[model samples]
Target: MLLPNSKRILLKLSGEVLMGEQQFGINQETVAELAREVKAAKDTGLEICLVIGGGNIFRGMAGAAKGMDRAQADYMGMLATVMNALAMQNALENLGVHTRVQSAIQMDAVCEPVIRRRAERHMEKGRIVIFAAGVGAPYFTTDSGAALRAAEMQCGALLKGTSVDGVYDSDPKKNPDAKRFDTVTYDKVLADNLKVMDASAVALCRDNEIPIVVFSIREKGNLARVLAGEGVQTIVQGNK
Candidate 1:
């Protein structure tokens, strides 16, 4: 189902998607294409907020597993997200789309601090706001940061653009017969460990009454199509 009058929405992207077909790191060509897709959505008169993950460059949990200090590793991961936000900002600006990178971690030389009112003003002036650094804290994932920003911004919905077309009962990659859901309850996602997102992120959206729309970002023009309610996607909401 289409979101009810989605004037403003949060678009959450995984950093791995920026890697394109490569094994690691940001791929410039891929970022440009994604920027075009975002611009198209913005041109549709929708205000956009973006939150990108840092797994493409570094994953804090992976570092912690390898014996690095969890907090320090997480900080490194946060910086990686800033790099991504800057790349996206550059790409969008090249396309003549006004964009701002508001980071949770203070970095005045590169981007603005995460000020809710300022971000709201930026959106009002037609600039896309990209939030970085995952709530500026260790332990919390970008998914959690996205949920927080979605709530703070009072976004109509949270659009999770991933490589997969939608949420499935199991890992579609591992299980060829995995069943995809057109609609799902937040509780079911949590109870089933569906992995639509982390448990905390799902709970935040559920508590705030924000719908989460999951769709494939790899598909060309899919973001716009999903926003139009004409693309393959899974909507996660509270039980009716």
Candidate 2:
């Protein structure tokens, strides 16, 4: 089955997903499993794009506590995303998924620079374009960068694959009584202070009319299920 009303989707996966059960670093098995799910989604005829976070390897804010400059740490974090992107590229290609890694910052020897037209061409050709490096700047999370890319790529929706199934009234793990929403309006998310994405990212999605599908990546094949509207997820889009 196809993702109803969606021809293209931008998937935002955190670096931690690549780490599997490990404390840090890429886990080969996890990446392979994720690639399979992505391939399934692709098989549904959706042109896919990826925007991966770098928290598994490094978080600029965390590095700053270790006496590293914020910009320096952020640059390091950006590089970490590229590493994750490279790992994903390898995994997807191994499965014959046909993938390309495009970094926001130009590093031609390592990967292609973020070129809008070229990226669009890749997607049209059914190649998964993995976007990395977080806007190629500091003081911004990959969430915002992902939103930007989703808008630029003209994707139908932004699928945020996280550890939790959906946006909750409170931290679900911390509060057993927390309520989960099947869907939420942009205003409700901001007014209720829901932890979907950062303010800038959420705002970008709202302004661009791009729906954000928040679902757990930990569940086996949940990404494909969510797209088919058969999995637990929260859709943050328009209206109250």
Candidate 3:
């Protein structure tokens, strides 16, 4: 229940969350559930912006490892993000939540190009703006995009919904002794390799002084709880 501020927020969702019980692609039922959560959150009157990753369908680095050119692979990854945005837009609209997909790579055929002021206007009008594509460039994960979008929109914090409840000293899945942290300094996370996020993402957020909340998105109401400071999660903050 300890928010740094009551300003608008940017939510970063991994594409793997959309996979649900499937091995790949999207699961509409799960997406609907997520949309309902967003609807509830939006009902709280907090302006929200979204940035989703394309890992479910593909990751540029994964493709490049298989022989595709790095730039071409990254563009492919960007396209994957657009697909997710459209899917999310559909689910949100079905729930009566007006949403828009804005991509960094001008894709008018599918969605609007990312226009800062336009996205701001959308938020003002109570619409959720979902940002897609990986900064329209290669070699960067969506984490960087999320940080950039959060900064560009002046969001209070970056909510990174993940499978784990919070950041740990090591991979909890592999290391059962990896201690979960409720609060940590940004430098500590990077120095100790806590995997709070990628180095680039963490560096950008630390530079911008944004708190990163890492929590479980599958815990039903955890997002709301974390926003209220009642959830099990890690809070990575800038050092004094």
Candidate 4:
């Protein structure tokens, strides 16, 4: 499915992708390559916002499963996202791309607070804004944070760059015969539990009428191709 004309977009990336082939944590080479791909897309004149998950460093749910307080674990996960955001910001700046890191949780030393107008101005000045901290609350995934920011920023679409090329009926890795959908409706995704994203994230996009384009960011040059409506992806939107 081809993406619609989008002047601004929010790119939601799984933090695990930042790990490259490592067991955990960010890989410098992988981050650099991803930055280049983002730079290529930016050169096309599209305003970009980024939200990277913290699964690579810490996963709140995983911690909670081990008997940790859910809220405390989630807060730790949020901080991890800030670290990832900083790494990405550094990489983008190294490539001569102006970038900003806005955290939902305020940290005067490292980044700016989430100010909607300020973020808009940064984008107006050709700066990519990376939002961190997952809505400044517990039990919320970065996916939900991405959706909230996309709606608030009035982004044309939310581009989810993940390991998989598109949403499938089942786990493609485990189920060899899993069916990949070119286009799927939000309602179906929620009903069947397709896992395109967390339920809250999907519902937010549905309510705001923002298209979610899921594609493989691991594939070099795929981000640009998807932005150009030429890559393999699944477009999740309101029913046609």
Candidate 5:
């Protein structure tokens, strides 16, 4: 997929990917590999920000379903994301890639608070900033947080790194004949409920004119390839 000219991007990764082959929790080796891929992309001179989900550890909706207070459950979910961010930060730093973890829910002792200007400056100095805590509020997913940060940072594109290669017409896991789309319109995604992202996230990207590129981050060296416009990915854009 040929993406638009994106000098800066916000990459959203699901917490499940950190599980690797495990049923739950983070796999250090896998995270190390992902960090390398991200480093490669950064080496290409593209500024990057990251937002990671907390599904592997906890899901707010699931907690709510179990009769927990919605807001409290969501807060736990947000903390899970912060943990993931810390793990990612460790991996990236171990690879000798300078990184910073910025949280929407401030824990100044652990990470810096969300400050757009500081984050921009970090990127300018070649440091990757990881945003955590999912918009710092309840009733929102990390997907929405990614979209919001992408818009706030004026990222050229929003990269969704998942286990799936691209966006499929149906649940590819269940439907063997499911077709993957190389290019899809944001409206089509929203209208069809493609599950590429939450409707709010998709709408935010659409409204901001930022493309969403969905690709498999599990694949070795794929992040760089996708950023270079030569990898398998689904590009979601305005009426594409």
Candidate 6:
């Protein structure tokens, strides 16, 4: 069962997850499975908001590093995220889960612009709101956008669904002996450069006293398992 204070959560998913086994672009079957998981979580009566990254399509920093204009690359990256948000929206709706896509960089024809009160109303009506376009600015990541929306929506927790199960002392893929943390302080995560999230995202959650739950999304049924506090995960919170 979730703590009494954790009725609402903001979920952040990397775009790569949408690719599934493919090297690039959205994989329909994978997204359907993810949508089912999300619907299952919502069925537990939790208000959910989502932020999806665009790394599978394009990354502003990667483009900038390859000689493109940084701001232009970032705008392109933002567009990529919008595409991903639409894809997820379709998948969720196919599962009979109502969802709304609100873009920071609004294209009114496709989706609504980010309006805090409107978003809250949507969730109140049992509709999930997916935030797209990171911060509406260059040099910012979707992680920061997720944190910002999580704060704006006053979500009790930010659930980061990644490939790894939890935050580790080192890169678990490279260091087979790396230790996973069951719980860790915000300061320790930042000081150790744990890579659980960008520094800004972590700091924002820390400042707001919102706990960040890190867990693997690829595993079947893990989202609900973690939400029920019965799965392997790392909880990042303030020092007691």
Where does model 5 exceed 4 Å of error? none
lDDT of 1 by residue, 15-111 (tens): 9999999999999999999999999999988999999999999999999999999999999999999999999999999999999999999999999
Taking the candidates one at a time, how many backbone clashes does each contain? Answer: 0, 0, 2, 0, 0, 0
TM-score of each: 0.99, 0.97, 0.97, 0.98, 0.97, 0.98
- For candidate 6, the per-residue lDDT at 111 reads 92
- Candidate 2: tens digits of C-alpha lDDT, residues 32-114: 99999999999988999999999999988899889999999999999999999999999999999998999998899989999
Instruction: Report, for every candidate in turn, its global Cα lDDT versus the true structure.
Output: 0.96, 0.93, 0.89, 0.96, 0.94, 0.94
TM-score of 5: 0.97
lDDT, candidate 4, 114-202, per-residue tens? 99999999999999999999999998999999999999999999999999999999999999999999999999999999999999999
lDDT-best of 2 and 3: 2
Alpha-carbon error at 25 in model 1, in Å?
Answer: 1.0
Q: Can you tell me which runs of candidate 1 are displaced by over 4 Å?
A: none
Give the per-residue lDDT of model 6 (tens digit) for 1-240.
654597788999999999999999999999899999999999999999999999989999999999999999999999999999999999999989999999999799999999999999999999999999989999889999999999999999999999999999999999999999999999999999999999999999999998999999999999989998899999999988
- Candidate 1, 80: how far from true, in Å? 0.5
Look at candidate 4 and tell me the lDDT of residue 152: 94
Off by over 4 Å in 2: 1-3
The worst-scoring run of ten residues by lDDT in candidate 1 lies at 1-10
Relative to the true structure, candidate 2 reaches a TM of 0.97
